[model samples]
Target: MDLQTLTYIIVGLTFVLYIGIAIWSKAGSTKEFYVAGGGVHPVVNGMATAADWMSAASFISLAGIVSFVGYDGSVYLMGWTGGYVLLALCMAPYLRKFGKFTVPDFIGDRYYSQAARTVAVVCAIFICFTYIAGQMRGVGVVFSRFLEVDVETGVFIGMFVVFFYAVLGGMKGITYTQVAQYCVMIFAFMVPAVFISIMMTGHIFPQLGFGSQLIDAAGNSSGVYLLDKLDGLSTELGFNQYTSGVKSTIDVFAITAALMVGTAGLPHVIVRFFTVPKVKDARSSAGWALVFIAIMYTTIPALAAFSRVNMIETINGPEQTGVAYDTAPEWIKNWQKTGLITWDDKNDDGKMFYANDARNEMKIDRDIMVLATPEIADLPAWVIALVAAGGMAAALSTSAGLLLVISTSVSHDLLKKNLMPNISDKKELMFARLAAAIGIIIAGWFGINPPGFVAAVVALAFGLAACSLFPAIIMGIFSKTMNKEGAIAGMVSGLTFTVAYIAYFKFINPEMNNADHWLFGISPEGIGIIGMLVNFGVAILVCKVTTKIPNDVVLMVEAIRFPKGAGDAQDH
Candidate 1:
């Protein structure tokens, strides 16, 4: 079958599968809508959590960014993966033990103040909105390319799909759908990696092939390590060595820290733990989710290398000058259809040359690397179609997760928990569905008019989460003295500081977004670390001066940390 037909068929089937799962697993009550009835098996919830964690940022854009930025992009790999481990080991079980419906609910009740909950709700909505923007954009990118629609049109289509499942099934629907998505995503990613690994290095595993010496079409070793050759080729093209990083050490640390803390604080991922029945199950599912997540994370660097090498070899040809424009591979024209890759023959040599300097003849968006990789390597139409389906799966799954968070924040946290304490469960469910529908529409708009690239936009959301929520949650559970006044003050200050810094550097003045203008040489992406510190410092300081915690609230904190009995605890 033609690539387009295969793509449509495969993508259509996955959508059908997702919708069917959503319909079958539809929530019947407020509890099911919010937490999937709180009876999910650890392994099942783990798979669902993995799908929720690995958005378009992971499956579609991480490799693409790594391919372009080389060693510097390792921060993303380390940050996101490390963050998940942190959440699982340090927070997930405790949050599960707290047994709140949402992050805001946990904060509100833990601090013994509705104000604390409202602040958390606002922050959750803000962070999830920013995060969902990237997923929506990812959906649009896939649709625009594989389905041959306008980017805006693609986003609207994604909005509808996500809206249908998210509004209908709520957490119950999203959880089961995510299990199917995880299977599709991992399969789609690994197949191409294995294919290219064998094609390039005579190895079955891309992870091994990344370091293995290259093999020619005759299956003879070229005697040069893959990374070594990539490094040499990179410098030849006027780019930094592929194995060398250029980001300052401090900035790298800050960005990684921000991402790590932010991942733990992400409301969507945290909610997955609530779906499981027991605290131990939360911990178990977290490990399972990590295993599933690592499958993709480990393959990213290898795929980045393989895709980069293939793209360069195709564009620059054997002689390394350029390829004749007319003779360029079919992949070039295919990507050009999406307007993601373009060429201009400046010198009129009728050849397209890619370089690191201003003389570069092509305008290639980094976001296209992964999608274009299979085509560049001459992978079959079915394999390419599978990737499109996988990308869509990744994008839609995460968007649904984020939309659920937004809805829960509004319907459960803002309304039922605080504003309308007397609301009926049925009415609350209706409001949750309404909130999800509206959230998707807004998210679709952001996707159509995204603020940045998929990964970059997501990084900012991570920063926001890091600054606004991680500190409060940490203190809430660990420090019995944590009060509403301190937590509220910390969240407001930290969030404000991070937003101001990001807005000033990223939006207000993009020209000065350099190390020279940055505070302590920290980029806006890494500023969240500073904001987090500020939050911690301010909250601790306020607690020291505030009135002592209530004995009742103190007792509650003790129980959340250490459940009353041994056998009774398990039964509870």
Candidate 2:
């Protein structure tokens, strides 16, 4: 079958499966809408969480990033994965013990103030929306490429599918649908990776294959290790060695720290724990999430190396001069049409040089490496089709989870709890669905015409979460003296500093977004760590000056810290 036909069959089938699951398990009440009736099995919830956490960024962007930055890209893998350890050990079980419908619920009730709840609701909504914009963009990119549609049309179609399930099924529907998506996306991701790994290094495992010897496109090896060959090629082209990155040790440390803390702080990730049946399940579910996530994360580095080597060999030849532009491969020609890969033949010699020098004749976007890898390796038509489906699964799964977070925050935390407490449960559920539809419309708009600042919003989401939410949640459970005034002040101050710093560098003065202009030489990506510390500092100081928390609030803090007899989670 043709690539387009195969893609339609596979992607169409997955969408049907998602919609069918949504219909079969539609949420019946507010409890189901918020936490899937709070009876989910740990393993099932873990799989759903895996699908939710591994968005298009993890599935599509990570390998592409690895291809360009090589060892420097290890930060993403380590930082993101390490955060789950923190989640499993430090936060998930306790939050599940607190037994609330949302993060803002936990904050507002634990801190004993509606003002604190309102602030958390605002922060959670902002964080989820910022993150959702990227997922919507991922949906658009996948559909535009594989479905042969314009990006706007792709986004609209994606919006419809997500809206159908997320609005109708709620968390109960989403959780089960995500379980199926996990299977589809993980299978699709693994197949292509395994094929490429075997083709490159004669190893069945991509992780082991990445460390094996270099094999030419013709299936012959020069007896050189893959890393050694990559290092030689990179150095010859004026790029850093593939294994030896150029980032300062501290920068790497800082960026990794920010991502790790941010991962722990993200509301979407934290909310997944609320779906499980009990505190033990919350902890176990995180372990399962890591196992599922590890399947893709470990394969990424290998794919990056394999794809990069294939491209270098295709374009630069063994002699290292260049490939004749007119004789470039079909994949190169196809991608060039999309402006993702380009060549100018600068000297009119028709030779395309990919080196870092001024005479270089080719430019390739790092983001296209994984998308183009199948074609570069001459893989089967079905493999390409599966990849398109996989990309959609990743994007749609994450978009659904984030949308639920947005909708629930609006309908439950804001309207029902604070604004309209007399609203009936049925009315609240309807409002949640409406809120989800509205969120999709806004996300679709951003996907079509994403603002300059929107691209940086993901990092800011993490920074905001780390600086604003993580400290409040952690302190509210661990410290009896963490009064409402202290929690509120800390969240506001940290969010203000983090957002202002990000805006000054990223949006207000784009030219000053570099390390030369950074505070303590920390990149904006890593500035969240500083922001996190500021949160701790400000919260402690504010608490020292403010009145002690109510005795009941202190007792509640102690209650959450002890998980013994923490029964099945139920939305209050």
Candidate 3:
């Protein structure tokens, strides 16, 4: 009945469902653990991939970002979804045809070098760990607010749930569970968005609501557009216009390109392509996956617009410049208790002003907006419960995917393939489960003590993927002459440059804030574009200075590109 009780019930039910699925589908062999025995249907695989891809960043943070940042947030919407198009058109079919167990398998064999594979493993692990930290933080934030627990404790509970399923089910367990998660999360996200849309604009579709005219009490058109109103409000509060072009055109173009490429290049996501039975299925799966993702992606802008308008209207009005602290709404009181949203009456006035006062700056945590949407909109308690469950589903599904990748790389790729060639499949599977459990523990700890915002950490992960892994994969596939030396050099250069750039801005230098960052005035968020260029350039330069590639490696590259010879290219 109450919010806290409802949250606990929802989370508890989802956890039970996941554990039950894990038990029912427990993996018995190395193949099952790694790729679900490669028997998954295309549509099912598509849904699972969507679940794996969305993560906490999509479910918890994206709309909140758009709500505050306005049209500039379209970069995230376009870049992330567009990356899937790249994956489907440029990467997925070919890689699935190559039929390797992991991204490194393709790199290692294609380049004919153990060193190249090792570099890929290093890069993959870096990206996964960085990304998982954010998901863990999302889980903690949802739990702390809904279930009324400390963030650390919430993270521990999340870690246990991830370890339970990932260790027991492996890819087989994770895949089926993710399908269920996708359903839960999508339903949770859409219900409140649709409700809010209908209430504000008398339209059922959020996309249309974003462009619709605001109606006044007299039923006359307000004449001012939603985007224009948002722009004006933001400027008044010392923030940039919501719909105006704040970032340079070049920076926007580069960031969007990098995100597209990086999405296609992520090792964990690429591995999902390998789980389907046929190469053709993999290609089709990408399209279906994008369809599922687009449902949320398209609606997010509308949610951002509605929430922004609602937030402003509630805080600033003729009768009350801001909501009175003592008489604040129930949702406000509930969220304030979590310390995610806070208010102060700096002027000792009964009314609250939504203005940008330094002392009265509202500390509305971004993650809370989606979770608290039901309460803010006065939806039924069941809807609020569903949101809590959905947030957990989003967080856990991603954590499972990341942990599975980490475990497989350690046990299957490194230990079984290289360190202990004589090891049995059963022993390797055992070690894989162990590695997954250990990885979950480490990830949970970081989630309990997050380093930054959810989107910031996710973007950094994308940057790393763009810098290191993307270059190596592209060069390895396209260039017949690229050798181990060149690939290694490129990866190291890209990794070092991107990481150093982020660290410099994030910690070492205060003045070079993300907004002011530039290589010729490019924002740090868009620096991945430059880092990718450096990778390609360094790889080509190093390859030219070195000897020609071996004849066998060239043949391998040819085989990877052509569908006819791909059937025999599987690792081992």
lDDT of each: 0.89, 0.88, 0.82
lDDT per residue for candidate 2 within 1-572, as digits (tens), equals 89889999999999999999999999989989989988899999999999999998888888998898899999988888987788778999999988888999999899889999999999998988888898898888888778888889999999999999999999999999999999988988888889988887888899999889867668887598878878888888888889987777877888899888888888888889988877888888988988888899999999999888888878887688888877877789877766678888778888778887785788998877877888888899899888889889999999999999999999999998899999998999999999999999999998988876655788898888889998998898789888889999999999999999988888889899777788888877888888889989999999999899899888888888898655554445
Q: In model 3, what are the clashing residue pairs, if there are any?
A: 321-352, 322-352
TM-score for candidate 3, residues paired by index: 0.95
Record all residue pairs in model 1 with backbone atoms less than 3 Å apart, i.e. clashing.
none
Q: Candidate 3: lDDT over CA atoms? A: 0.82
TM-score of 2: 0.97
Candidate 3: 10-residue stretch with minimal lDDT? 562-571
Which of the two candidates, 2 or 3, achieves a greater TM-score against the reference? 2
Q: Write the per-residue lDDT of candidate 1 for residues 1-572, one digit (tens) a residue.
A: 89999999999999999999989998999889999988889999999999999988889888988999999999989999999999998888888887778898888888888899899998999889988888888888898898888899999989989998999999999999999999999999999999999999999989899989999879999898999999998998899999999999999999999989999899999989988878788888999998999999999999999999889989988778899989989889878988889898899999889988866898888888777778988999999999999999999999999999999899988888778989888998999999998998899888888865444456568888999899998888888898888899999999999989988888789899999999999999899999999999899888889988789888878877863221111100
List residue ranges in candidate 1 displaced over 4 A: 452-457, 563-572
Q: lDDT per residue, candidate 3, 191-291, as tens digits?
A: 88888877777668888878987666565677877778788777777777788767778878878887887787888888888888877788878989988
lDDT winner between 1 and 2, please give it. 1
The lDDT of model 2 is: 0.88
* Top candidate (lDDT): 1
Alpha-carbon shift of residue 148 in model 3 (angstroms): 0.9
> Which of 1 and 3 is the better model by lDDT?
1
CA deviation > 4 Å runs, candidate 2: 216-221, 453-455, 567-572
